[model samples]
Target: MNGAGCGSCHSAPGVWPEGEVGPSLDSFAQQTLIAGRLPNRADILADYVRNAPKYVPQSGMPAMPLTEEEARDVAAYLYTLGRR
Candidate 1:
C-alpha cells in the first residue's frame, strides 16, 4: 500500500515543485481521462498504469506495471484526493 507515487511530484499540500515532469494527483479523480481519451475509471486507470505505451504510442508517461490490486488501491487513493 505504499502508493508513494503520490510523492513523486507532489509534496506538502498543493505545491507541485517546479521542474517536476509528472502532474500532481491531488485532484486526479476529478479529471475525465488518463491522457484525454481513456476513461478515468479505477480499472482503466490501473490498466493505463500497467500499459500506457500500448494505449498511447507517444505518451510521456511510462508504464508502472502495477498489479490489478495495486492499481485499484492507487485509483481508490486518487479518488479520495478529490472533492466529492
Candidate 2:
C-alpha cells in the first residue's frame, strides 16, 4: 500500500485521516463491484486499481502507478477490510 496514495482519496474506518475526495473504502471487501463496473475479485481489483480507466471509463480514480506485485498486495489488503 506504500506510495499508492490510496488514503489520499478513500477513507476507511481506521486506516487514516478521513479523505474528502472520494467515497469511503471501509467496506471494500464486502463490495460486489469495483468502481461499480467490474467484479470485486482480487485479480480484477488489482488490475483495476492499477489502471482505473481501463475498467471503469467514468471512474474518477486516476491510474495508480503500482507494479503488478504491488497491485496484488493492495488487493490483498483491501480484502481484509470490514472483516474485523
Candidate 3:
C-alpha cells in the first residue's frame, strides 16, 4: 500500500508516520467487525478498505485507488495484525 496512503489515516504496526486521524489497526485481526459495522470477513474487508465510503457513508475513510488485487493484498496483511 505504498501510495495507497493507509498509513496516513490508520496506525498499523511497523507502518510509518503512526497516523492519528483514524483508529489504530494494530489489533485489526481480532476485531469482529469492519469499522464497527460489517463482518470482518476477508473479501468484505478487502473491498471495504478499497472503498470505505461505500461501507460506511459517514466514515472519514476515503476510497482507496488500489486495484482488486492490491486491495486483497492489503486486507490480507491487515488480518495479520496482533496475531504475532
Candidate 4:
C-alpha cells in the first residue's frame, strides 16, 4: 500500500519526510483515541484511513482511494508504531 503518503501529513518513527500538517504518529499505537474523538481501534482506524471525512467532516484529511483491505492493512501497520 502507499501508506507512505501519510508521512507527508503525520510524522512517524520510520516514515519520512516528517510533516507539520498533522500530529506526529510516533505514539499512535498508544493513543486512546483516533483524531482525538473516535476510539482508537482497528476498525475505526481503517475507516479513517479509507475516508476520514466520514468520521470528521471538518478533518483536513482527504478521502483515500485504497481498498477496504488495503486500508485495514495500513491501520494494522500503524498500530505497530511506537509500541513501548
Give the lowest summed-lDDT range of ten residues in model 1: 10-19
Report the lDDT tens digits of candidate 1 across residue range 27-74: 776898887888888877777766778899797776775788877776
Ranking by lDDT: 3, 4, 2, 1
Could you say which candidate leads in TM-score?
Answer: 3
Top-lDDT candidate index: 3
Ranking 2 against 4 by TM-score, winner = 4
In the range 1-84, model 3's lDDT, one tens digit per residue, is 546888887898888877889999999899999999899999999999889999899989999899999999999998899875
Quantify all predictions' global Cα lDDT against the true fold. 0.66, 0.81, 0.89, 0.83
**Residue 37 Cα positional deviation in candidate 1, in Å, after optimal superposition:** 1.6
Off by over 4 Å in 4: 1-4
Model 2: residues >4 Å from true position, as ranges? none
Q: Which stretches of candidate 1 lie over 4 Å from their true place?
A: 1-6, 9-19
Clashing pairs in 1: none
How well is each residue in 1-84 modelled by candidate 2, as lDDT tens digits? 535677778887665656668777888888998877688998898998889887777768889999999999989988988865
Tens-digit lDDT string for candidate 4 (1-84): 335387778777767778879888777899999988999989889989889999999989878888888898888888888878
lDDT of 2 at 79: 91
Which residue pairs in candidate 3 have backbone atoms (N, alpha carbon, C) closer than 3 angstroms, thus clashing?
none
TM-score of 1: 0.71
